[model samples]
Target: MAQQVQSAIPARSGGNHPKGLPYLFLTEMWERFGYYLMLGIFVLYMKETQGEGGMGFPAVTAYDIFGTFIAFTYLTPFLGGFLADRKLGYINSVYLGGALMGLGYMGLALPGLGFFYASIALIIIGNGFFKPSISTLLGNLYSEEQYKDKKDAGYNIFYMGINIGAFVCNIIGAFMRNKFDWSAAFLSAGVGMFLGLIVFTIGLKHYRHANVLKPAVAGDTGIGQVLSLVFLPAIIAGVLGWMIPGDILGSDSTDAFIAATIPVIIFFVSLYYRANKDDKRPIAALLAIFAVSVMFWAVFKQNGTVLTDWAQNYTDRQVSESMEQAAGKLYLAEEVSSKESMVTQYDNQFRTLKDDNGKEVKAMGRSVYFRNIDPARIPADGKPVYLVNTELFQSVNPGWVVMLTPLVVAFFAFLRRKKKEPSTPAKIAWGMLISALSTLVMVAAVYAGHNGEFKVSALWLVGCYGVITIGELFLSPMGLSLVSKLSPPRLTALMMGGFFLSTSIGNKLSGILAKTWYNYEDKSHFFLVNCGLLLVSAAIGFVMLKWLNKIMQEKGVK
Candidate 1:
C-alpha cells in the first residue's frame, strides 16, 4: 500500500498549496449544495398543505422529522468513518457516498411516503460514508511534510467551500420551488450532487497518494468487537426505546436516539481507558471537547427548525414596491393572498382550535404570516402581498461565513504574529461564549416583535446569524484541525466520527427543543433557555481549558 501510494504521487505543482485543494474544495462545496438545498426546504415541504404538494404534517411533526433526519445524517458518519478506515479506502468511500446521496436526492422527486423515507435513508447512510471520508482525505493531503504547517488554513478553506455551497443552494432552491414545484427543487439538489461527483472524479489523480489506508495498531479494537459491543447493542436499545414507552423525552425518535447512543457513548469513553499510555491524554481531551461541543451543535442546528419557523412566521418579509418586480422575477418573493378562506382555526400558539366535540374548528382566515401583522400594515382585502421567500433566510449564516471568513482569518493571523493567539481549545471555548451571546440576540428579537404579535425586522435574523457565524468560524474548522493533529494515525477517521457523534446528539436535541416551540407562550423564554444551555457549555469549556491545553502541549500540537 505504501509503495502504491508513493508511486501514485504526482509532483508538487508550482503553488503554495497542493494541487488537490481546489478539487476537494469544489467537491465539498457541491455536496453541501445538494445537502443544504434539500434541508432548506425539508420542513417547509412537510408543513405545506397537501393541496400545495407538501406532506401537510402538523408543525410539531415536521419539527420531529427534521430533527430525526438531521440527527441520523450525522449519526451514520460514525459507521461510515469506521468502514472507510477498515474496509473501503477513502476515495472509494467518497465515490460510494456521493453516488448514494445523489440517488437519494433524486428519489425525493418521486411522490410517495415510501420514496420519501427511502430517499432520506439513502442520504443518511450516504452522508455517513462521504462526510468523514472527504474530511479525512483532506487532512491526509496536508499530512505531507511540505503541507503540514498549512493544515489549519486548509480546513478553513475547505469549510469556506462548504459555506459557499450552503450559501448559494438556498437561492437556487427558492428559484426552483417558486418557478416550478417541490419536485423540481429536489431534482436540482440531485443534479448538484452529480456535478460534485464529476469534480471529484476529475481530481482523483491529484489525491490518490493521500488515499492510502491505515492498518489497525496493536491496541486498536477489532471490527467484530465494535459491532457486537457497540452497534448491535445500540440497535437493540433503540428498538426497546421505541417500543417501551410514551415519549420519554418528548418524542419516540428522540427517546430512541438517546437510548441508542448510550452504547456508542460508552464505547467512546472506553477508548480512553483502553488506549495505550501514549494515546490516553489526547483521547481523553478529544472526548471532553466532544462532550461540551454537543451543546453548541444542539443550539446551532436549530436554524433548520425553530429558526426557519421564526423566519417564515415572525420576520417581516415584506418587499418594498420598487424591488417587488425584481424580486418576483428572481423568484425571491412569494405572493400570499390577503383573501380569507375556510381553513382550520388556530390560536396564537398555533395549536389547532377545537370545538366541544373534539373536532377542529374552521374559520375564514388569511395566511399565518398575516396573523400578527398590524392591521394598518396589511394590504387592502383580496389583494396579494409579496414577501421574501422563507428559505432565503437559510442563506444568511453562510452569507456571513463568505463575507467574514477572510476578516476572521486575518484577525487570527494578526494575533499569531503578536504571539497572542489562543490555542485551539481556547478558541473553541471562546466560540461557545460568543454563541451563547447570539441567543440573547434572539431573546431581544422576541421582545422587539412583541412575542410574535407583530413581525420583526429581517435584520434581527441576520444579526443573530452574524454573531453565531463568528462562533462557528472559531469552533467548527478548529475542531476538524484538532482531530487531525491529535488522532492516532490508524484512528484519525474514526475519531472524526467521534466529533460528528457529538454533532448527532446535538442535532437530535435541536429537534427535541424545536418540538416545544408551540408550547412557549413567551417565545423569549425559549431563546433564554437556549442561551442558558450554551452558557453552561461555555462555562464547562472554560473550566476544562487548562487541562485540555496541557494535553495538547504534551502531544506537541497547538
Candidate 2:
C-alpha cells in the first residue's frame, strides 16, 4: 500500500483547486441522479393500483418497504468502506459498486415482487461499496498540504453536484414516467448510473493518486474478525427479529433492521475504547455527532414517504392555463378526469377503503385528489384537469441546494476572511436548530389546509424544503468535511462508513415515523412530533459543542 501510494503521480492543480474536484463532482452528481430518481417514485410506484401498472400495495406496506429499502441502502456502506480500506482499493470498489447499482436500477424495470426485492438488494450492496469510498477518495485529495484549507468548500461544491443530479433527475423521472411508464423512469436511473461511471472513468487519472490503499495498523480489526463478530451477528439478529411471533417495531422488516444494527453499533463503540490515545477523542466526538444527526435524517428523509403523500393528495396542484400548457408540453402534467366513475377510495387518514369480505371498495365519482379540493376548484362537466406530477416535488430540496450553495459558500468565506467563522461543530449545532424550524412550516401548512378538508398551496412544501435545505447545507456537507479532517488516516473510509451508519438508522426512523402518519388526525401534531425530535437533537448538539470544538482544535484542523 505504501509503495502504491508513492508510485502514483501527485495531484495537479485545477485553477485554485485539485484537477480531480470537477470529475468527482460530476461523478457524484450522476450517481445521485440515478439514486434519487428511483427514490422519488419508489413509494408511489408501490402504492399505485395494479390496474394502473404499479405494484398496488397498500400505503402501510409501501411505507414499510420504503423505509427498509433506504435503511439497508445506507447500512451496507459500513461493510463497503471496510472492504475498500483493507482489501479492494478505493477505485476498484467504486467501479464494482457502480456496475452493481446500474444493473439493479435496470432490473427494477422488470415486473414481479421477486425482481423488485432482488433489484433493491443489488442497489443496497452497490451503495455500500460506492458511497463511502468516493467521499474518502475526495478527502484524500485534499489531504495534500496545499489543498487542506479548502476541504470544507470542496465538499460543499461536491455536495452541490449531488443535489444537481438529485434536482434534475426527478424532472427526468417525471418526463419518463409521464411520457411512457414507471419502467421507463426506472430504466433511466440505470442509464444515469452508467453515465456516472463513464464520468468517473474519464477522470481516473486525476484522482488515481488519491485512491491508494491504507494498510491496517496493529490496533485495527481485520476483515475476518469484523465478518465474524459484526456481520454474522447482525444477520442472526435480523433473522431472529423477523421470526419473532409479532411485530416489535411497527413491522417485521423494521424490527429486523433495528436489531441488525445493534452489533454494528457495538462495534463502532468498541473502536473508541481500543483506539490509540491520539485517535480516541476524535472518534468519540464523531460518534456523538453521528448520534445527534440521526434526528435530522429521520425528518429529512420523510420527503419520499409522508412528504410525497402530502404532495400527491393534500397539496393544491392545480395550475393556470399557460402553466399547465407549458408543463403538459414537457409531459410533466398528469391529466385526471373529474367525471363520476369507479375510483379507489380512502378514508380521511388515506388508508384504502375495504369491504367486509376482504375486498377493496371503490367509490363512484371524483379521483382521490378531488376529495380534499374545494368544490369550486374542481373542473365541471367531467373535464380532465392537468396538474403537476407529484414526483417533481422531490426535486425541491436538491433544487434549493443548487441555488443556495454559492451564497452559503460566499457567506462562510466572508466569515473565514473576518476570522469569525463558527467551528464545524458550532455550524452543525446551528443547523440542527434551523432544521427544527422547517418542521414548524409543515405544521402551519396543516393548519392552512384545515386538516385535509382542503388542499394547501404547494409553497408550503417549498418553504419547508427551503428551510431544511439551509440546515442541510449547514450539517450534511460539514459532517462529511469533519469526518475527513478528524478521522485517523487508516480509518478514514471506515469512519465515513460510520457517518453513513448514522444516516441508515435515521432513514429507518423516518420510515417508522411515516408509519405513524395516519395515527395523527390533526396532522399538525405529526409535524410537531417531528419538530420535537429535531429540537431535542439540536439541544444535545449545542450541549456538546464546546467539547467537540476542543477536539477539533487539538486535532490541528479547522
Candidate 3:
C-alpha cells in the first residue's frame, strides 16, 4: 500500500488558506446531503404500514435498528483512522469508503431481504473509513500558522455546509418518498452519495498535501498485532454471542452488538493506559468529555425515533387548502385522506393497554390518545390537505442550524474581540444546559395536549427544534474543534476517531432509550428524564471547567 500511494503533497494557497478548502467544503456538503437524506426517512420507512411501501416493523424494533445502524456507522472511523495513519493514507481511504457507502445506499433500493441487511453492513463498514479521514484531512489543511487561528471559524463554515445539505435533504427525501416510492428515495440517496464521490475525485489534487502517512510511534502496536488483538477477537466474540444458546440481551442481534463493542472499548481504554506522560492528562480529559456527551446525543437523536412517532401519529399535520394546488404542482407535499378511519391501525400500532393476563388489549376510536383533537383541525373531508410531509420535520434542526450559524459565529467573534470568550469546554457546558431546557418545550406540550389526548400544535415541535439548534450550534462543532486542538500531532487523526467512538456509544444508548418509549405511562416524565440527563452532563462539564481550561491554556488554544 505504501509503495502504491505517495505521501500527501501540498495544495496551492490563496489569501488566508488553501484554494482546496472550497472544494472540500462542497464535497462534505453533498456527502452529508446524501447521508442525512437517507437517515431522515430510515425509521419512518421501517414503521410505516406496508401499504405505504414500508417494512411495517414495530416502533421499538425500528428504533433499535435505527440506533444500531447509527452506532456501527460511527464505530468504523476508528478502524479507518488506524489504517490511514499506518498504511492506506487519507485520500484512498476516503475514496474506498465513499464507494462502499454509495453501493450500500444503492443496495437498499433492492426489494429483497438479502439486500437489506447486506446494504446496512456495507454502509457501516464504509462510514468507518470515510468519516474520520475527511476530518483529518481538513485538520491538516489548517496546520499552517497562517490558517491555524481561523481553524474554528473554518470548521464552523464547513459545519454550516453540512447542515445546508441536511436542511435541504428532507425536502428532497419527502418529495421522493411521497411522490414516487420508498425505493426511489433510497435510490436518490445513493445517487447523491455517488455525486459526492465524483466531486471528491475532481477535488483530489487540492487535498493531496494533507494525506501524508506517518511513521508509527515508539511502542505503537503493529498492524498484525492490532488485527489479532482487536479485530480477530472481536469477530470471534461477536459470533459467539450470536450463537450462544441462551438469550443475554433479548435478541441475538443485541447480544452481538454488545459483544462487538467490547474489543473496541478495550482498544480505547488501552489508549489511555499507553499514553505518554505529557499526553495522559489530555487523553483523560477527552475521555471524560466523551463519556458525558453520550447523554446529550441519546436525547438529541430522538428527533428521528420517538419524536418522529409523535409527529406522524399525534401531531396535527393538516395542510391548508388555499396552497394545496401549488404544493401539489411542485410535488413538495403529501395528501393523506383525513376522513380515512385510522382507529384500527393506530391502536394496533401503539398498543394502548393490557388485559388481566397481561396480554395487550387494543382500544377503539383512534386509541383515545388522539380522540380529543377537534375535527375542524383535521383536513376537510375528501379534499387533499397539501401539508408538508412528516419526514420534512427532520429538517427542522438543520434548518435552524443554517439560520443560526452566522449569529453563533458572530456571537463568538464578538467575544473574541473583547477577549471575554468562554473556553471551548465552557461553551460545551453551556450547550448541554441550554439543550436540557429545550426538552421543557416538549414537557409543556405534553401538558397542553393532556397527555396526548389532544393534538398539540405543530408549532411545539418547531419551537423545540429551534431551542435545541442553538445548543447544537454551541456544542457539536466545538467538540470537533476540541479534539483537534487538544490532541498530539501524531494522535490527531486517532483522537478524531475517538470523538466518533463517543458518538457511536451514545447512538447505541439512544436506541436503548427509544426502545422503552412505549413503556412511558406519562410521556412528560420521559422527556423530563431526558432533560435531567443533560443537566447532569452539563454539571459534570462545569465541574471540570478549571482543569479543562488549564489544559487549553497549556496548549495555547484558549
Best by TM-score: 2
Q: lDDT tens string, model 3, 1-558?
A: 111111111111112455566666666777888888889999978876565567767667788899888988987787888887778898888888888988888788887679889999999998888888888888888887887866776677668778887888889888887778888888888888888788788878888988888787887777787789988887888898889888687666667777987997788778889988888788878877877778888888888887887787668765566777877877778764544444333452363343577443433333233345686655455444555678889899889988788778777777878888788889999999999998999999989888887777899999999999888878888888888888777777778788888888888778888877777878898899889999999999999999999988887886
The all-Cα superposition gives candidate 1 an RMSD in Å to the true structure of 4.2
Per-residue lDDT over 1-558 for candidate 2, one digit per residue giving the tens place of the 0 to 100 score = 212212221221112567787788888999999999999999999988888899988898999999999999999999999999989989999999999999999999999999999999999999999999999999999999988988888888889889999999999999999999999999999999999999899889999999878898897899999999999999999999999989978899988999999999999999999999999999999999999999999999999999999999899998887687787788998988889999888887777787897467896868888888889877677788898999999999999998888788878877888999899998898999999999999999999989888899999999999999999999999999999999999999999999999999999999999999988889999999999999999999999988999999999988
lDDT of 3: 0.79
For residues 158-217, what per-residue lDDT tens digits would candidate 1 score against the true structure?
A: 788899999999999999999999999999999999999998998899999998788988
Predictions in order: lDDT: 0.88, 0.91, 0.79
Please say which candidate is ahead in TM-score: 1 or 2.
Answer: 2
Better model by lDDT: candidate 2 vs candidate 3? 2
- The Cα error of candidate 3 at residue 121, in Å, is 0.9
lDDT of 3 at 121: 93
- Model 3: lDDT of residue 550: 90
Looking at candidate 2, what is the lDDT of residue 430? 93
In terms of lDDT, which candidate is strongest? 2
Candidate 2 collision pairs: 340-365, 341-365
